[model samples]
Target: MAEVNFCLGPHVGLRPAVPGIKRAPDPPESYSALELQVAEPPVQQLEVISGVESVQLPCRTTAELHDVVKVEWTDSGDRKVHVHSCVPEEPEDQNQVYRDRTEMREDPLRTGDLSLTLRFPTVRDNRTYTCSVYSRAGRPRVETRVELQVRAQQVEVDSGAESVQLPFETTADLPEDTLVVWWCDEPEPAKKVHEHGTESDQHEVYRGRTRMREDPLNTGIFTLTLNRPTVRDAGTYACRVYGAGLIFLREKTFQLTVKGVSVLLLCAPTAAAVSLNVSPNLQQFFSDDSVSLSCVVGAQAGGQAVKRTAGGQTDLCGSGFGTFDGSSCTVSGLSPSDSGVYWCEAACEQMSQQVNISVCPRNDFARCPFILEIPALPVTAGSEVTLRCRNKDGSTHAVYFFRNGVHIRDTTMQRVKVEEFSVSEVQQSDEGLYWCSTDLLGPSHRSWLSVRAPPAPPPPPSVSLVRLICLLVVVCLFCICTVLMVLMCCSRKTGNKSPVAMEMTQCFGEYDDIAAGISTEHDF
Candidate 1:
């Protein structure tokens, strides 16, 4: 018999089973069995084995055995197994599966011996069994569970086969809340392949390739139909059952060996090499740039394309923002979210090649006015100049100034707020192409500036030699007029005397001195 465990609570430890001593039935010469009261939903047992001639289902009671008014037994499928009725005073209504296959121990009614003996048990009889005991009057009903398992089995299947089914199954009359799970036994913790419940987390590898049979409980077919079985599918398959309260009723494992070619060859081409390439070998793509990805197969055709985004999920190549042909894929208006790895899968080949892609958003500097203004161009070397940045539309966009294509300063402004970047003591290095832009998205108008040394000073004001000569001539003429006037006055005063004439002559001679003196004065 397989080991069975009972769970009372998740945090609590397991409850050990009470050992029961073997005993013979009463009136050994003439065997008799009683019908046990069946629970609305059948109760499950802990353990049972196939190929057993007889097995004892033990039940314990705290009250006296004689005081027990009635005891009942039911199979995992809610099938009537046996009933011992003290009120009716008889055993009846034994299910056909166990009609003459059941017996009671001696003094059961007197000793409260609620144990059941199942005769000639086989694989078909392997299941959960419930035993319920009811006392006289106001006593509540007591229920216990027992689960049974058959020996391990092995099954074989063909690789690349359309479908493979596991033969394990449960009876049709299961409770509405029955849950079943099929999983791989090895690779410990068991990889789940399929499940039937409110929630299930099936393994990714088995997704879309595995499913459970329809109406499993009613058809007693717990088989899992795996579509397109591969060699990796060959492993031990386990099926576990749960009752209404999510109680673990039973579980069984079967070794599955897939026969045929290796799964690797089936899933992929032999010695096939595929490559992924992007046109223009773009490391960064603008938002509106069109992108095309080509799968270059080495002497092969029918390559399948796939893509993975930043989230590390593999999806069809053109599923999102692209259209994929057999050999290539194209995407337009690539955004930041489109950055990830792109994969190319060659037809009939398990191998794939991937290339990383990056996308960037386009900047629109054209949206805002971008102008660079130099206060004065061809400016002096030692002059302070301001480069005024302005936008005609008066937007508060961030402005970046660049000199000869190199960024100089970045600033933000409000409406009509000019970015006055001053250059102190302008130098040769400051003479270059200067441009301002709202952002890197668009182009900006550039202007050049030239720096040079300061100009020479003008000569001081002075009089010419010609102008001095002209002034001297004018002074001589004025002196001559004054002398003539004085001579005229003397002639009028003294008339025609020889002595006067002689005196005049002397006077004239003296006058020569005076003229000489005047000339001397003029010279001074």
Candidate 2:
């Protein structure tokens, strides 16, 4: 138990003094109870142009304390101020308006920082605010005046027309007398379309199409609708508030165009008849001897038809075939010129279809005549001769040469060599009626040869001498007959005398010419 002390210092009544136990010494001032002091009051910054949702305040203090601290706030303004703290729990004592928004914590004391946040802040709610801090040793308080400002909502639209619709999310608290205006660069005169109040502000073009929530003043919603949108109905539109000196603006645009379909052509084998079909006009077929072409068409009412060059579309008749209709097309009469891929196009309602066609030619070398010719004949034996073998059809594919009904060789001879068969020299052995023939393509031709031996040499002169001697003997005999005739004539006269007489006459004449020096060897 500690001692008790009673003492009365001179003032009102009689005094009594009883001090038996010594009192504890008073603590030094440094360790005594303390009270915090702020150098300046907290102040919320203000701006003429401001946002509707938030406000900032600048505040500072001069208090120096080393202990846990607690902060308290009170909204002194007439309007509601929703207070919020970055800390975890709500403060001990707070205004009813901040009952749901207030927060507090111990972390701020450790960091030596303090701040308060107000939610759903507004211009009308701006006012003075007071903050008090309770420390282990003392209590400190700060007061600040905050000015609030409201910034106008901004809207923008992109369009060529004079006016457009205005759209908004929350329209609550919006005044009924709010003004909305439409703006754009006027070609002739620069002016703006101004309307007052949400009710009377009707744009002629957007009149029936405009609408708002039942309680526009409370919901703060303004919506404009367009029933039949047109290109001329597009431009920038905005809402303005005259009292608050604020302007809220929004912008829009529209575009217009026409629609349409297509036409196509089709063709096939270039040398043959081509087929085509169309809804609008009949297809045309054209050809030279080398190529045949077919045109396909579609109705002009729905679309346009055009000719597409080669390689423009896929061929319906395989890779080389060409198509012309929206479905298919073809071209025929295939020549060298027509031997390419073709395309046909059908355009309708801004859409088109393409088709491809291909063409090819038939081979004509298979039908030439097979007849061959053998130019000249009557070749001499053993003399070199050439046989010309030619096809009447002029086809060299089947030209073959034959000798004596047997194929000897092919006729690949040069100019004159093709004319005849040659033999080095004329001999009796080569005396046959020789000929050459060729099965060029169709028929064959044959030629003949005529060979004869030369005449024999003249006979010897000895045989002629022999024949002359014989002729001499016959002359002698004839002479003897003549002598006999004469002798007989004489003998007829002298025969009567005797035959010896005639002989003696002949012998005597011969001996007499001989004795006379006439060479008798010539007569004898």
Report lDDT (CA) for all predictions. Answer: 0.60, 0.37
Query: Which lDDT tens digits does candidate 2 get at residues 1-524?
Result: 43221211112122222366454553332342344463554466555322233344433354443322345555555433433232344443455445444343334443434555554343334466555554333334334455444433333332212223445443357565555443322221222333333424232223333344455455655444332233333333333333234432222211111111011112222222122332212111112222223333333221223333332122333244433343343444434233222222222211122112212122322332321222122234445544333333333332444543444443454322243344567575543323333343332322223344444567675657889999999999999999989987886674455577899999999999877766555566
What lDDT score is found at residue 273 in candidate 1?
57
TM-scores across all candidates? 0.32, 0.24
Clash totals, every prediction: 29, 68
Task: Give per-residue CA lDDT, model 1, range 169-251, as digits (tens).
Answer: 54566777888888786644357778874224565335455666677777767777775565656777777777776665555
